[model samples]
Target: MLNHSAGIRPQTRQRVLDAITELGYRPNQAARALVTSRSQVIGVLVATRAAAYGVQKMVYEIEDAAGDAGYRVAIATCLSDDVSVRDAVDRLVAQAVEALVVVGPQAGVFNRLTAHPLAIPFVMVASDRHDDLSVSFDQVEGARIATRHLIELGHTRILHLAGPVGWVEADARMRGYLAELADHGLAPRPVIRCEWTADSGYRAACEVLGTTDVTAVFCSNDQTALGLLHALHESGRRVPQDVSVIGFDDVPDSAHYRPPLTTIRQDFAVAGQRAVGMLLAQLRAAPPPPADPVRPRLVVRDSTAPPG
Candidate 1:
């Protein structure tokens, strides 16, 4: 019998551990759960069908962090409109997850989740509501930085290609863009609200062609910027020669864009780890440590320059 309370000889303990290792012995999770009244599992609900770079990277880090904390992760994915947030939570709760982590910018998630309250603690990722246990890269600040860069490059007539409505991140980024322009005493130009896709961006840019006298454009995301670039190219407007373009969430392929993208770099891994850490604290009945929103940096590239 291996007695943990009674001090066993070190040699004996080592031999027992070696034998367990050699036999590939594993602990009985069911028995442990019975004793502790916990499933030792964390549920992650992501509101995206096609995971983008930031979402994909953050999920990876969250899984690693949860593993380090001696818990398993169960993931549930739902579309923005196809599946309701309540349905996703019900699925996770059915699995007996000890805690929950919701990821993405769907603002309606808050009210929906509040309506169907769960006994388990839940944390949010990449949300504008900081009053709760949430982790996010400051979207507004990143937008401000991107917009300010274009401003400093001598482009006063700047246009913002905004993200879809009802997204917390989209609202924050738009707020940042407005604030930056106000600080510089630049008049707010037309804000083209579009979907977060290259196609939408291209279409939006086309609409701006004959209507606006914009010299620079800040897209909500890298994909949108890519489309904007395509539109400019097709319209015989040389990038940085005719107009400067900037984007947010420096995705992996941003660096390889025709002109390489000038965008904001988010530390998704760090944010992921933080969100997981908060979940772990709840599991242990420990107070969560104070965490600040992750700061984003500007990556200067060929896509932006002083306006001609």
Candidate 2:
């Protein structure tokens, strides 16, 4: 009766339930798992360096969705290196997680998992699409949207402030910017690489301002844009007048920047829900649905305008 198993009369079950409620009885999950052989746990692996706003939002959404489905989520953090990735996986597997979600942005995590496959179902949340199970927003398209917006505003000498070299998101955004420029027959400028930080962006902007004479800059992320805006302000260059700026990832604080930023908004919540749904379908042996990447939209703000 306590387990809600069938074959128990309603009156007897009600009496037992009333007594249990009066006694404040609780069931032990460990013992239940032993008898039922279902851990009802989903494991998530996130790289310590990749825990940005978007990734954090996705993790929270995944946890909420899993709870609604009667499953608990266990999260583990690891470095991007192979050894750390392996150790994190071991810890999660020890918890008897039925499924896994990999949120690390580095290529090493994928390489390690490919070399040694897990028996359980797993999904990767990445910027680039893979042949295996994965979910991502259309990074390339998002960049194109940002660049196209600048081009449509009549800015031709557009520069790109790229993210760290070799990062999947950085590479994708760069590709999108290049492709859009090529489509427009505009010559590409040299990319200034920087880490995904305001300080890096500030330094890069300070250095590049001496030689580069571009009318607009497309930043890899909003934080980079914020730094660039600060640098431009300090240098007495007005935004959307001397140089227009656009950025990716319409983070919450972007709108509050000195001059509100124009950016691309990624639907992290949708991606999280879809990832969890895919894993549940795999566990049930059901046919996995189409693996379409999430679409991103452009958000126009005060930071971009026609070249002066």
Candidate 3:
């Protein structure tokens, strides 16, 4: 046991340090927890159907940041089902994590967590704003930028292949799409909601491509855009010449798509860092001031052009 109040001689401290280093000694976590009443662990809760590139990237950053802060991360992945999030929370609480960084969709989770009020500090990355403990990228603005890009290229009959309902990002993107269309005085087009997968996008695109009066389509994410591209190719349509497409989440592969994909880029790394910083602040009893959201930017590529 090391005592800070009764100072030790410099030589004694060095000897202990040298002996520990030579012995390759490691601290026993159980003993340390008994002394400090802390687990030195941060719990991470992830609940999503589409654990896409952005979510993966963000989780990596969060783990990195937490490690740098002298804390280990305990991850719990939950399904999109009703009771899974609560179960996930229960598991994390059982581990006695000092804080939590929740990523992915947590629709009803806020209420459940609030009602229970786990005394530990937590930061959630999702659609709902939680006073100051929530952090999120601006999905609505990202969608607006994607849609405005198509409109700038003179695409009138634009269709939005949206993400499934009950997702906050999906709702925000849908609202942004509708807002942009309304701003242009264009009648609202019926949105086709699909899972955030290439297969779902392919199926949706195949069903709507030939029948609709659409010359442009804005997909919710890059995977969906990839599927749409494949569908368009099979349907005897030339990208940018006959149809224009835009996507969200400018994923790594988006730039390498056949004609390349025009999409919105969200800085998942920055968002994760910010969320971790906030959680750290909460743990340290100091909350950071409200900051601007991580905004998404549009990257134009060969996939989009003026409708022929």
Candidate 4:
């Protein structure tokens, strides 16, 4: 009666439900799993350092979607090293998770995952469509949109403040920036590599201001852009006046920046929902659909304009 199996009379079912409520009985998920071989749990793997706003938003969305579908989510946080990733995977597998979702921005995490394939269905949340089980916001296209906006504003010498070298999103954004520049017949400038932090962005901006002559700059992420904006302000340069600046990941705080930054907005909710749906489908033995990268849109603000 509790399982709601068919063929029970309504009166008997009501009586059993009433009795259960009077007894305050709760179903034991562990005992049920033992009987039915269904853990009804989805595992999520994320890197500790990669827990940015976008990643956290996606994870929240995934959890909500899974709950709506009558499943629980088990999250495992790991460091950005091979050993940590392997251990995380082992931990989730030991939990009898029916499926897995990988949600870190590190390339090394994916490399380790590829080297050690899983026995169960899994989906990777990333910007690259490297496999059928991957879902992402198109990082490359987002960069292109940001760069093209600056180019159309008549800024010819645009500097790219790239993210850490081994990060996947950073590399994709850099590729997009370079590709857009090439399409406009502009020579690519040397990229300044920085960690995905405001401090790193601040230092990189200082370097750029000291050594390079540019009309604009594109940062790999919103935090990096925030640092750059601070550096430019301290250096007595005006945004979109002395130099235009743009960033990626239209984070919640980007709009609150001093200059209200222009940025690329990724649909993290859509990405999360699609990733969960894909994993569910895979678990049901359905054929995987073609992997399509989610497109990002640009949000214009006070930070970018025609180079003065």
Q: What order do candidates take by lDDT, descending? A: 4, 2, 1, 3
lDDT digits (tens) for residues 1-308 of candidate 3:
25453577888887988998999998887688888999899999897756889889989999999999998889999875648878998899898899988885646666656677778888888645635778877888888898999888888899999998888888889999999999998876799998898999999999988789888999998999999999999988999899998999999999999899999999999978988899988888885856577889989999999999
Candidate 1 per-residue C-alpha lDDT over 1-308 given as tens digits, one digit per residue, 9 for 90 to 100:
33374767788888989999999988877777788888889999997665778888999999999999888999999865534667788899988899998896777776667676779998889887674488877888999999999999999999999998888878889999999999999998878898889999999989887678888999999999999999999999988788899999999999999799999998999989999888888777898966688999999999898988
Per-residue lDDT of model 4, residues 192-241, tens digit only: 99988999999989886878889999999999999999999999999979
- For this target, which candidate reaches the highest TM-score against the unseen true structure? 2
Q: After superposition, how far is residue 108 of candidate 4 from its true place, in Å?
A: 3.4
lDDT of 3 at 29: 76
Off by over 4 Å in 2: 7-25
lDDT of 2 at 132: 41
Q: Candidate 3 overall Cα lDDT vs. reference?
A: 0.86
- Going through the candidates in the order shown, the clash numbers are 0, 0, 0, 0
Q: Please name the candidate that would achieve the greatest lDDT relative to the true structure.
A: 4
Per-model TM-score, in order, reads 0.89, 0.95, 0.92, 0.94
Task: Go through the candidates in order and give each one's C-alpha lDDT.
Answer: 0.87, 0.88, 0.86, 0.90
For model 3, the superposed segments whose C-alpha errors exceed 4 Å read 1-23
Q: Per the 3 Å backbone cut-off, how many clashing residue pairs does candidate 3 have?
A: 0
Global fold similarity of model 3 (TM-score): 0.92
Q: What's the ranking of the predictions by TM-score, best on top?
A: 2, 4, 3, 1
